[model samples]
Target: PLGMESGAIPDDSITASSYWAIDHESYRGRLNGVGGVGAWAARTNNFDQWLQVFLGMVNHVTGTIIQGRHHHNDQWVTSYKLQYSIDGISWKTYTGNNGSEKVFPGNNDRSTPVTNLLVNHIDARYVRFLPQSWHNWMSMRVEILGCTMNSKFLLKA
Candidate 1:
């Protein structure tokens, strides 16, 4: 997650609303979810400021994915993404940045696994992620490794 706005932040209490402490060593491995889910964070100062979220309804029998370690640029990672949504407000095929992950300098991206996520019938509530921009403020750590599924089991990738 990344943030800066409050008038584009000069330290006006850090804008965009200002909330901190979410870089819990960044999310690395093991994830699962279900319907009506949503994620799109905003935190950090700059070097740690990165964001481009789009998360919602990760359903597919209680959606959960994190197969075999994904995310790089090491150093506790500073960029990350994983997007999906059916009607959370127009969004599809995007695991990270512009869709089709493998980001750098914090551009995050993901998607395209037969529409990345949001099962077949399209009812995805909302799910988003594009955190850690990494500028300097220091605060981003995105990583993943495991997840199975849950939330009504609509298995049909």
Candidate 2:
């Protein structure tokens, strides 16, 4: 795991388009964060809302694990799309083997985590989860699944 729950990924690396409030802040969007409201909630519930993470360096991202707002079954992301970037400027959406954009299914409830593995691994330093559909409102906690690229491989890429 890239460590949203384990804190291997620092708080500075986690961010979102907008947060509901301090308690529902972006940094709290880590799997099983402080407990209640242990997820990031957007200021507005819409398709445009997003939660992002900076991996610090390029990693072979294989999948993602997601959950909804803690203890609140009504508030959770139902579906989302992933976009990745190497420099945080130019981005490319994760696609299927046929090259169409992929929409990953999100949680059905608040606590049970949902996992989505990529068909092709993405080598990127940044990954953003853009909500496509949600339950009550846009809210989620997430963790990236992958390993850091070897230093030599990173330099070559």
Candidate 3:
């Protein structure tokens, strides 16, 4: 786990285009937090909204786990696309084997976790989630899957 669910990832590393309120702030977007309502909720439901995470260093991102607001059952992402960056300036969208931008399916209801394994793992320091379709409003709690590079590997790179 990348540590959002466990609070290992700091609040500074989590951000979003906009949040509904303080309680639904980006930093609250941790799986199982606040009885599951601690998800990041956009101020408005739109295609431009995004949730982002900075890993502090590059990591091999293999997959993602997402969930919606637990108690509400009304707000949740149904689908989304991923973009990753090494320097936070230039970004590349994750693509399918066909070389098209890949859209990952999100949760159907609140609380239940949905996991999606990447067909091509990404090595990145920053990752953003762009919601495509939603149940009512765009909201989500997420955790990234990957392993950190060992000292030897880091030195070689």
Best by lDDT: 2
In model 2, the runs with Cα more than 4 Å from the true position are 151-157
Best-to-worst TM-score order? 2, 3, 1
lDDT of each: 0.28, 0.90, 0.88
Q: For candidate 2, lDDT tens digit of each residue in 21-114?
A: 7788889899877554778999998777889999998999999999988854468899999999999999999999988999999988888899
* Candidate order (lDDT): 2, 3, 1
Badly placed stretches (over 4 Å) of model 1 are: 1-18, 21-78, 86-100, 104-124, 138-157
TM-score of each: 0.22, 0.92, 0.92
**Which tens-of-lDDT digit does each residue in 75-132 have in candidate 1?**
2224444444656457553333344553323322221011122222222333333443
Clashing pairs in 3: none
Model 1 lDDT at residue 42:
32
